[model samples]
Target: MKDNGSTKYDLLIERLCETFGALYQGVTIDKNWLCERFGIAERTAYRDLARLAHVLDEVSNGRFKLTANLLPSLHMGHLAEFANFAGVAHLFPHHDGQSLRKRMNNADNIAIHGASSRENQQYGDLMNSLDKAMTDRTEVTCFYRGKSRRLQPYRLINHYGLWYLAAVEQGRLKSFELARIAQFAATQIAFEPDASIIEELDTTSGIRFGKRTDVTLHVSAHAATFVTRRPLFPAQRLLKEHEDGSITIATAISDQNTLFRWLRYWLPDIRIVAPATLSTAFMKDLQARCEPTTSEQPQDA
Candidate 1:
């Protein structure tokens, strides 16, 4: 069941969208119309209408409509960007601005195509709610990975098309994937935002922010060309370029799995130069994946 506070806000947004849509179609609305349609008291309707006074114009006594340039002048680029980032444009009310949304979707060039965008839509709502909690400096309680957690959402990050929240849970900083969150709701408790948390989020990759480990990688000249063309991460630094067409790059890695993925992506051209254990683990994982399983064997019929 939706909470009353959330329901009320959603209803208000719905009514506001309807009113704006009517005004855009040259149909004026009055207080009585809103009250009757939404089954709200006159005073409540007036208050709701007043909330939109900045964009609404009173054409006649108690009758209101949007300004002539309201829709055309409305800037939806930023909101569209958010929708694209969260992949939740479908969750937005269709009656709000169907044509405008269509245009925005078609023109969205920031979201990389072929990235995994078709995740569950509820994740988008979860991400947006977490973002709101962060902005409001409120806490959120949710069941993540079968454990209940109260999180002070500090920073929201979009890394390589995945969304993560850097939060303080149980007095420790951690990163949680938006998709893994279940049963999330904001609490009344508020806390101060930590700058170090935000800085850590900006420097980390994906859900990897904890104790830093200095790791280095050596890439062949052919791969170096590609690596230098695009930074693996903002903190990544080129330590040396060897004459034998190999370059050494270094960065602080927090998650070994993340490094494994990066190495696998540039296999044969990249090798771990430090942290022997991480390199061995990467090689073992690669071999395990490449080795054929018994299930693949052909049985005599």
Candidate 2:
């Protein structure tokens, strides 16, 4: 069947513009470049550019162009001279108020303004992945660095303040922490996610964020009573109590941030037992902070 002329033209123009986005002044795009990049004819490329090359040259002044992912080996200006270019300067617009430091700090906040800002890179990545997963039902293989495993992503879950991934690689279902993940690339593999995934997430995951990992911590009266007195999170429940006032507190979470901060307040009372990851991080941070630091003298004084 013959190709549709309009569709072909649109495709050709799209290819040409994408190439133009990466072109720089010194580098001239030729027939061979078009063949290497798009495997199209020189005639087709020239035809596509006939209507637009003049405008592009006028705008770019022959400097590097092309917004395509690939970049040619043309030399961009040095770091100092980079800011001198109009195009580079437009990439960073000047704001009226707000210091740069304040802007940078806002970008770093994981949950800014209480709504979990997009400024946080990790939060953005996870939210994007979760959104894609929920909408597309695409299978993902993540290099999850949770204490349990590495480089495996079969699920998406968030806990208290942490992130988690669940997997059923073998027949066994397991949970992993998001902070442990190194990176992830969504796989084209499709799946019909099991209902158990949600069930385990709800049960094993904490009451708040759905991190499907839990620990039954051993506690003495100080912790048991304090838990009864104030409570760290609603997910924390008093499981059993010994006649000696000792108790087993079932607290679920993805990472140690919650337990560590809470136990730090408890000092010697609460003892974490089940999840070793939380325990290790807590001890490591505690050790580092406890080692006293040297004092510095003011030179001006």
Candidate 3:
């Protein structure tokens, strides 16, 4: 039987792992043995071994072993290359092999603390269903937020350590939080995946979907260095840097709350420059927040 979409990927991962395991044990493996062991075609086995050709050395009679240099330590470069081939390089944060290897080896030197993404175990079946639907270009029917939704499944996106399904419902691009999705089922109805939607998903910098508006801001000299040091917003662009150490930047935001929260954090150091309405609204909001509440009024002596 032909392997389904996710099964193919799973089988590939399994084959790669077993291949490395055998190589690590100093056992010589050949395409014929791999075909027999994995119940795969000889061509598929050849392709699998070819992916590791960079780190494998022939050991006579069509068998190959891990290059001697790689045996002393796990060669991260070769491993990264294999990961890239398997289409899982994005799963890792570091693109460079050296940095990743260092982090792996120097565990005691690093301190990591933050809200990490929840494991996908609960959504495994849902993710698999969506993956197959996307792979097959099929439509999906699911319940989102206690309402039935018919969507053209596009891509699974992870933003800010949360998983979301980016799909089209009623001809509008939207993101549904993975935790909220339920009763997902694939339909035989197939639809052509729009290239534009795919491009938008690839280009979108945040989970907030739908139309986006560009907001311009002025970063005072006091905060320019901090703002320029790293990207603070989605699709951030440095428009101009003034000689006085101040800078002008622009970024796209799909949700006003996201921008508002960011502005609140930066406070006086950052101010909206364009779309005067946003600036006016932000100032009004600040003034309202600064106003004394009835409960804080001075009581009669």
Candidate 4:
């Protein structure tokens, strides 16, 4: 009793695949049930079952019933893709995409990275802006605040989960933090036949002062707090904590102003333990603050 008279062979294969997949989960694949489902004869149901077993063996070496051991065929990154697709095929709770049909297709073709990158969320946005700026190669005025001063768009950088925009303003290179930016809107003012380029202020590595600095430090041979503390900076490694409780914490800071203040506060708690020069600077500041002033009224002398 068939009416859809296309290819009974194709229908047989599809039903066989489904029946086998369901049976792998302990569901019984009865020939009577198959006849009822696909409106095929009992004889055709038996033939389909044979084909299903053959196909599974050929593809998976008997490992797959419903879902294959994906690692044998796919990257771990692709698991995220599958999850994303499942979430979508279940119907998007919010339709941000243009076409529901296209979304379904996109879900079917997804590839995702299982591991997370440390890049800040703004990194992607900055990259997009940089792409636009690079495409235009123009003077884009991004609203840092107040007056929208114009800037020559440059490059975007991603460093240790931070996003930075390197641009030129009034012929001086400026590095702006994407997080601190109030708004970013590229302006139309542009450059052409630009023979002039600023080199000295070429900001890189998120540094405004674009200079290789020489620093020096000094430490008390007796101060100690890092004996039980973790490495303070990403590059920091625990060199040693001396027997006298003096611990040496090694770190390189992007800026020295904050570190200098912190070292002062950690006074008596810890010391610089290096370079000799910073220790002297701290001592000088401390001595200056402690100096007795000269405003005396005679008492009983």
TM-score for all models, in order of appearance: 0.57, 0.34, 0.66, 0.38
Where model 4 places Cα greater than 4 Å from the true spot, the runs are 1-75, 78-131, 134-139, 143-174, 179-184, 187-209, 212-229, 234-241, 249-254, 273-277, 283-301
lDDT of 4 by residue, 141-196 (tens): 56785656677766665444456666777766667767766656776766762433
Per-residue lDDT of candidate 1, residues 13-93 (tens digit): 898887776666555678888888889899988887888788878898888777767755444434455566665666445
The model with the greatest TM-score is: 3
State residue 267's C-alpha deviation in candidate 4, in Å: 2.6
Expressed as tens digits, the lDDT of each residue in 1-301 for candidate 3 is 6659889788799889988976775556898889888899989988988899998999896889899987746555566666676455665688456556666688897775544788878888889989999899999998888799999989887776788989999898999998998888889999988888888898887778768888999999999988888688899999998999899999998888789889999988999998998889888988898899999999999
Worst 10 residues of 2 by lDDT: 110-119
C-alpha RMSD (angstroms) for model 2: 20.0
Candidate 3 stretches with Cα past 4 Å from truth are 1-78, 81-99, 112-115, 285-301
Where does model 2 exceed 4 Å of error? 1-119, 122-126, 144-156, 167-183, 207-225, 230-301
* Deviation of model 3 at 198, angstroms: 1.1
Q: What do the candidate models score in CA lDDT, each in turn?
A: 0.77, 0.58, 0.84, 0.55
| TM-score for predicted model 2 compared with the true structure | 0.34
Candidate 1 lDDT for residue 148: 97
As a TM-score, model 1 comes out at 0.57
Who wins the lDDT comparison? 3
Q: After superposition, how far is residue 244 of candidate 1 from its true place, in Å?
A: 3.2
**Pairs of residues at least 3 apart in sequence or in different chains that clash in candidate 1:** none
